[model samples]
Target: MLTLNVVNKELCVGDIRIVGVSSASIFLIGDTEVVSLSSMFDTPPESVIIAPFVPLPTEE
Candidate 1:
């Protein structure tokens, strides 16, 4: 899975007060995904980004 840290410093889009979400998109260039991180409360997140689907790597 993609991580939020790859995009920005925080877990949300705008300020923690306003509305935004932890979102990211995966692009398959070299089998790598470009992720963007942000957040939402009870509702779903906005913005539609698309990319290839790859399984998350398992930890040793």
Candidate 2:
């Protein structure tokens, strides 16, 4: 059993610039009662490839 409550009177913002946001993420400005975020990145042993060394040609 769980109970949550949130009350906000006033909120103001001028300018907000965000470049990038990745994975399990939560971007909030005002108010929040409860927030839960979880991220899991698993790379297996046999899930990787290694063998490449090619340089790009430069402009003359």
Candidate 3:
């Protein structure tokens, strides 16, 4: 199964690579990122679990 680190310092993400979103923030991810991440595992996982979105603070 594929494994991933929730946090990493060396990895660089740009603004355009967002995958998920919340009212306050966005998830930075891309197709290439997923493919590269998938390769990290010897066996594929059944599915990926994503967190639920939440509301962000309003911008006055």
Which candidate ranks first by TM-score, i.e. highest?
A: 2
> Which stretches of model 2 miss by more than 4 angstroms?
1-10, 42-60
Measured on C-alpha atoms, candidate 3 has an lDDT of: 0.47
- For all candidates in order, the CA lDDT equals 0.41, 0.60, 0.47
Tens digit per residue, CA lDDT, model 3, 15-56 = 443344653443444333453322243455766444666544
Candidates 2 and 3, the one with greater TM-score: 2
Q: Flag clash pairs in model 1.
A: 21-38, 21-39, 22-38, 22-39, 24-36
What's the TM-score of every candidate structure? Answer: 0.16, 0.40, 0.19
lDDT tens per residue, model 2, 1-60: 466666777888898755544433466897766777565547875885533433435545
Ranking by TM-score: 2, 3, 1
TM-score, cand. 3 vs. native? 0.19
Best by lDDT: 2
Question: Which scores greater on lDDT, model 1 or model 2?
Answer: 2
As for TM-score, the candidate ahead, 1 or 3, is 3
